[model samples]
Target: MDVRFQTGSKRFNYRAAGILIEQDHVLLHKQVDDKYWALPGGRVKLGEQARDTVVREMKEELGYEVHVDHTPWIAENFFHYDGHDYHELGFYCTLISNQSYFQKGPYHGLEGERLIYQWIPINELNEIVVQPEFLTAGLRRVPEHTEHVIVEN
Candidate 1:
């Protein structure tokens, strides 16, 4: 799909993210060409629920099954990056399985390469140059409370 962004035009895109925190560290993927790290999730497919999308993406990307136990942790992040508009939903999930495998995937890296997965501490997010939405809204600490926030365009 071609996303059209006019000058000063505010467009919204729907995407989902999974926050898999283990041992106080979150799982992130490093794009080969970019210094920023991203969470393990993708755009929600048509007719697919957000929770299902997260589960499917985790299985596809990380080669393990995940369980989404609750609603969104962080919601409605508005940000402009690389000349595109993004409004994203970030959810908290628990990693139920321990397994790793490689397969063809999307979100190619700098050299058009697929990323190898890794886990990093939340404190190190700044060093990795993550997406601003994630840096600002997605990483907020909420103890047992999942809250949603809307981002104004």
Candidate 2:
């Protein structure tokens, strides 16, 4: 099961996300009903390495193999969603696509939802609400070193 839980005042999650860049644009999953943009990954399953989780999530979500280049950022994110406060431990990694999936626009989410993939240009990061604020500001060029980030909402 996923390492997620809810208490009276907060919900905690252990999740991993991938940052895939192509043609000077970054890929983000925008749920039709969501208020913020999200990365292309899911909860980090128990007994799985964070890097492996990134690879697995890409395959599960996009139906393609992705190579995890390196850990660009690790974050401890705190935010509010709906009516609940969230505390999330997130792993953000850069992904390398060996070849294209060659699918058309608007792919289906593997987790039983019809999701949409939006390729936002790196320059327009501020146009939308992206969680973990650190990314929207600094995602254009992934850092060469792994860095820990903290976000408080």
Span of ten consecutive residues with least summed lDDT in model 2: 100-109
Q: Can you give the TM-score per candidate against the true fold?
A: 0.67, 0.90
* Model 1 misplaced stretches (Cα beyond 4 Å): 1-11, 89-95, 98-112, 133-140, 151-153
- Residue lDDT tens for model 2, 20-86: 8887778888777877787888898888888888899888877768989989889999988778999
- The CA root-mean-square deviation of candidate 2, after full C-alpha superposition on the true structure, stands at 1.8
**Model 1: which ten-residue window has the lowest total lDDT?**
101-110
Candidate that scores best on lDDT? 2
**What lDDT does each candidate get?**
0.60, 0.83
Tell me the tens digit of each residue's lDDT in model 1 across 1-153. Answer: 322234464555555667777665667776566666767677677677777778887767655677776654566667766677665554444444454333333344333356746667667666666653434335656346666666544
